[model samples]
Target: MPRRHRLTPEKHLKHAPWRFTATDKAVLTRLAQYRYLKSLTLQKLTGRPIATVNYSLRKLFDRRLIDKPHRQVEGFNHLNAPDIYEINARGRRWLTEEVPEVTTLSRTHTEGPPKHFAHSVAICDALAEIELEVATAGNAFIPAATILAKATVPNPLKMPCTIEHTFPNGKHERLETFIIPDGVYGVRYPDGRSELVFLEVERCNPRNPQTLFRASLLRKTLSYRALREAETARCLGKKSFGVRFIGLSDR
Candidate 1:
């Protein structure tokens, strides 16, 4: 396999100052939304060619507007995975200052890649695929932001519920837990009807013992069940909602 060309500050400076374009702004916006994304993912989200996306990323990196987490270098290089990028303070400031209309929340800036980097990336990939498909179907994809803006409940994403379970000794217990999903989105059909859905990405870990994994799954199932019984969808101004789990392999 051919080696990938590294972008150095010296090489970046040799060219004229990179002017921000629409595509560059789109890349920053996406970084703000996803927090961390792969170079290929950005290409798909921006609907730009890979070369163009790389060019924009390089320029943004040179300007200190975006970052490549050092942790990704070794693992991604070995696997030939696309480079992961994140927005930095400067990038968020640029979005707020230059593109006043763009929303740049404090969460946009991250210290580094998440502990579960692969899992996070999988969630982003699933959301992107769904968004693209919804657009293709001529339906409007309502993102979490819109849902939150219209929600009557505070922090609806992090729902709290009580779970009841029995021990081997036949003792019953009630535990308080939270049902936090990976994401929330809605699909507005052309017929003026909308469907709200919660997303959960589940990845099986071979290292985890089956018993432990099953217990974890059970807790999640119970949490969702509790939420359904409580009619938590009403908090979001909906009578009902659906939970979609995207199962992933350990690979």
Candidate 2:
């Protein structure tokens, strides 16, 4: 078998003022997925040390490729939380020019409280894990498009609502719609069978059986059921996709 051609900065890009390394290319490729990532997340995704990741990230930050959310202040009560980093316009352009493996470039920025910050980090972490796992096994892996409510693509998912009717047959009709998950992607196995997956990252700790039945988890399950039972999407030629929600929970 021929050797796999791993992407290298020198091979694809011109190294002038500052040199880009394998780790740098890896960072850019992963950021191609729409999400904000911190140094710890990058360390985990790239298998590099915290210092090394920080060094590379700082360089990228200096070059105007990445920036922390303007609102996040690294101070007391928020320990071990890496600075949230998102690719900027320059970063997007550089990735598009330097990396052929990166087909698209999208910007993801974060600006909010720390808990909310943690939630998004958890989401990126989950996606990064899947990307690594599938690629390691040589299976075909497609990263999901980032779900942004404000983005251009129209989202079909809607919040649960009640509709009133004037007729005596019924007082009202409960309108239900599926929830757009944190991420969505497809995976094709070697046997030609494939699966579309929906990922939900719950940063909160696991709840008890009783408590779990009413909150976000319950709503998510109902939405998944609605989508699957109703043929929300079709795959291949005849088979419709049944989304399986992979929940990533962290303390």
Candidate 3:
């Protein structure tokens, strides 16, 4: 049986940059389907090497589009069990909002001598909503109007609702506060698939230290989560998934 997702509108993860790339879109699409993955899976899926996949994974984490879920079987060689990977809310949004809409020659057309950079606000807004959808995973149903309503409001910080968790045996080992709003959405990637992606938008500084630091933290957290979730599901014989991050820069 296929997996089902649950999304909410509350603010769980950070935002994706304005300028996401084509490769980035492909990666995100992969995650939207699987939810989690391993580096070897990605290499096989995308026909890339482990080094390239690792590098892209780092970049995606920095942009905050993906997160880790838990670990799973690692190597096919029987060397030992390796870690599993999962996708987060951000990656889902990119897949639905950005990737499928892309035409094969659109990139070349845009960069051709004619020079057509038709970046539309509607498109951006759509992407944002898609991102928001991924952030919520498949838990809830969120409408674009609701997001616009919140975005229009002046920093109210009021999501439709919120949820608090007490997972003593979980990794956080404490009461966790997860903002659960009505319009949240999130995406997951296939385990060890190359479709996982990273997107980054550079509107200001090409190298923002602060953003980078937060992104790193988010990635680590996401990776750990994917691994844990996978193990739990495997042990319990339940459907498992993972999360991957993508970064986008508009600059």
Q: Indicate which candidate wins on TM-score.
A: 1
Clashing pairs in 2: none
lDDT of 3 by residue, 99-156 (tens): 5542110111121112211122122223444444554554332322332343433332
Candidate with more favorable, higher TM-score: 1 or 3:
1
Candidate 3 residue-wise lDDT at 165: 28
On the 0 to 100 scale, the lDDT of residue 172 in model 2 is 35
The lDDT for every candidate, in the order shown, is 0.75, 0.56, 0.37
Q: How much is 100 displaced in model 2, in angstroms?
A: 5.6
Candidate 1 clashing pairs, residues 3+ apart or interchain: none
- Candidate 1 lDDT over 186-230, as tens digits, reads 999999999998887787633222332233656776778889899
Give the TM-score (vs. native) of candidate 1. 0.81
- Among the numbered candidates, top lDDT falls to 1
Clash totals in order: 0, 0, 80
What is the TM-score of each predicted model, taking all chains together?
0.81, 0.63, 0.30
lDDT of 2 by residue, 1-251 (tens): 65522111223233337987877777776666645676677787778888888778767766667666654452312334566677766777788778865532122343323456556655766666776687788887754432232234344333232222232443333344445566665677899977766667664534322332244555566556665555554322223554444554333
Model 2, position 36, has a per-residue lDDT of 66
